[model samples]
Target: MGVPLLAIVAWSGTGKTTLLQQVIPLLKARGIRTGLIKHTHHRMDIDTPGKDSYLLRKAGADQVIVASDQRWALMCETPDKPLGLTELTARMDHSALDLVLVEGFKDEPVAKIALWRRGVKGEVADLLDGYVIALASDKKLAIDYPLLDINHPLSVADFIENWLRTGQ
Candidate 1:
């Protein structure tokens, strides 16, 4: 089996994207090959008109791929709606990824690191297990899980590295 994945979920302004921007690069610096799968609650557009991939998809193709000397993009359009993490990962090649740092899907079976800014803590009733394995915050809260310094991405990145290298 491939290395297990974890989703990093938190409130909208809790710095999830900012933290990922910091952590992902550090993980790569440490030689960890990571794959990311982001779940958005809203519609998004990664394609623009006249782009080769866009044109192909407009021609009734279910999936369109465009690659160049630098990067590649794959757009899959369909009415098929998939369930949680298991179904999602099945669409990807797990062998190529050591860890999948998913950006959303709070209620998924995968482990999670909760993001909470010091003063912005939410009511604790709905945010426990299958929710937070750790906290990335500006100040320590009364939570039980390990506390992470969100400002220090290396530490967080190291935590992810260790979690993947071992079963912590």
Candidate 2:
């Protein structure tokens, strides 16, 4: 009953991030309030060394919030246990969003649009599951689910807009 979540999933080297970069602006043009959560395997840190927030966090603060007139960010230390998608989603400020787009968590059981590119080592056939509502690819394939042209961001945005309207 909160912001509906949809994932754009693909194997590494696929255009999931690139596609989302284009699609997000298009979605905003259509008045959809969107939020995003991207997952990465590499170790990442947003806090900068010598910054007050960073220094405070390094001094055993479990969480640190840096605020300004323009924006704010919360950095939480959880090295002992990584949070899963559900927990992460719950932490977002849903009051300002209509939808949340997930970049990874491909194995999670969420409704998703799978992406595939020709010669990308993995087959589009293997990406399908009951949770997949659509497939975006560089080439067309015969499939039961909706097919999307990965090269065209407008078409992808159109599909998402329609999906939002229809609650699919």
Candidate 3:
């Protein structure tokens, strides 16, 4: 079977990352192997300037991989085309993971749980649209979707586990 994918989406400062940090460990405790993909709009460089890898990349190498005992990372310079969610997911090693939790890509066509907090700088009406299977929020709202407590990771994990089992 293909690796199951889900997204935790929200506006800025809604604790998407914080919830993932808790939920991942909880899922692991339940013997679920998880992979993660995070999307960012800002420009970022994993390699430092003046380093050998950076210098080689600056010289126009398309891809650079650095490996050591603890970890290995591959860096590719894509100046023209930014990779979409499908392309990024295709690059992951899916054989070992049961689920892939996407931290961003709110516009991607995937199953998602939207994190909503009161007084945050986003419209709840627009944020709730499209592929949002559930909502985890700090305060109760008058919506018909399944509501989850944003502070409770265990309950959220249970909800995710049920979704995985039933494919709902």
Candidate 4:
């Protein structure tokens, strides 16, 4: 089995990352070891251009590992299509995490909490898809699932903690 996972999904500019920044610390205070996987559409690289790792990768090395006392990172070249959620999760160290929070991957068929803001573009559309177990919005709305206050990170963290304990 995989580590328990929950996704926080929303349109661009809806504060997915911002809310996570707040909620993660609260979860940590409760002793939840959370791992995260963020999906981006941009072509980006984390290594510096002239760094040895970057140079080696550019020289056609398929994978490279950089290590230090603080941390280590593996950079691998995936020339094919982007990996799906399961494939991506397999790369993570599941034993080290109590929960995995995903940002984006809005279309993936995983348990998710949909976030909404009143004025963001695409606000009119319904996000209550089959996989969305909860909705967090700035304003209240009638919905079958639990509705959380997007502005309050504590409540969000509470809901997550409860879910972790009971699988609700």
Candidate 5:
């Protein structure tokens, strides 16, 4: 697929994941295949500690690949060695899907929509720099692209769709 990757970035409480959950299926209904890459700053547990997969990870392998009848998961020892933003996009699968909706990687290559909920610390949005293609909030604001209400996810989703469709 030649469709470009897009990202939804926001602070802890700004609803990045929720927004993606709403928009992705909408895009899917229109025949857009989507995939997601999420980031976790804190330690996370996937495999049960006593499970075989957990044992393998404890054995110190740099990468762990697990597959089963209906699912698969990969755990990698990826450090802070991001090859910058653009290079990270190149490392993902872009050939078989319409879009890869990555979460986090705010410092990486692709353009992003910054979910700016009001009352959240400005420090959060401040980190995004110019990567913000649009801003979403529950309150109204005179943003340059389009001011969107956080509760009305439809408009935000539409914004993303129009951005991609018009080759913006």
Candidate 6:
């Protein structure tokens, strides 16, 4: 079976990570194996400086793998090429996850739930443009889509579970 993917999209400071932090454990408690993908505009480093993996990459290794008994991580340096959502998701180990929750990549043409807040501009059009399947907000929004409470992660989790089950 193909891995189910959903994107959680919102403006900065809209608490996307906070909601995911709450929802991930709830999903895990239900025996759901979840995978997460976060997209950032700024540069991020998973390897620390002076570590062996870091040193190897600095010495011109294209890819570096750091493995241990507990876990393994692979870091690939792509200085010239930037990967899109499809390419990035394709690189994931799909067999290991029941669902893939994508945090950001708002323009990737995937199923998404948009977290909205009052005074946040430039995202209302996304809902109207049909890019967002559901709306989660702290304030009441009079729209024709599924509206969810941003404060209640359980309900949001329920919504996500239903979506995964029914493919709606």
Residue 6 in model 2: shift from native, Å?
0.5
Candidate 6 clashes between residue pairs 3 or more apart in a chain or in different chains: none
By summed lDDT, the worst window of 10 consecutive residues in model 1 runs over 118-127
Clashes of 1: 0
By lDDT, the candidates rank as: 2, 4, 3, 6, 1, 5
Per-model lDDT: 0.79, 0.92, 0.90, 0.91, 0.74, 0.88
| Residues 45-122 of candidate 4: C-alpha lDDT, one tens digit per residue | 999999999999999998899999999999888888667889889999988999999999888888999999998888
True-structure RMSD, every candidate:
2.1, 1.0, 1.2, 1.1, 2.6, 1.4
lDDT of 2 at 15: 84
Write down the worst ten-residue block by lDDT for model 6.
Answer: 122-131
lDDT string, candidate 1, 68-123, tens digits: 89988777775687456776777777777777889988888778987777556574
Q: What digit string (tens of lDDT, one per residue) describes model 5 on residues 49-126?
A: 998889988898777889989978777665656345455556666776777778887776577777777677665437
Residue-wise C-alpha lDDT for candidate 2, range 51-156, written one tens digit per residue = 8888889999999899999999988999999999999999999999989999989889988999999978787877888899999988879999889999999989
Compose the digit string of candidate 3's lDDT tens values, residues 1-168. 568889999999899999999999999999889999998878899899999999999999999999999988889888899888888888889988889999988988899999989888997777776699999998989897899999999889999999988976
**What are the per-residue Cα lDDT tens digits for candidate 6 across 1-168?**
468789999988888999999999999998889999999988899999998889989999999889999999889888899888887888889988999999998888888999988877756655444667899998887887799999999999999988888876
Q: Is candidate 1 or candidate 5 better by lDDT?
A: 1
Return the clash pairs for model 3, or none: none
For each candidate, how many residue pairs have backbone atoms clashing (under 3 Å)? 0, 0, 0, 0, 3, 0
TM-score of each: 0.87, 0.96, 0.95, 0.96, 0.83, 0.94
Candidate 4 residue pairs in clash (backbone atoms < 3 Å): none
TM-score of 5: 0.83
Clash pairs for candidate 5 = 85-108, 85-109, 86-109
Error of 4 at 40 (Å): 0.4
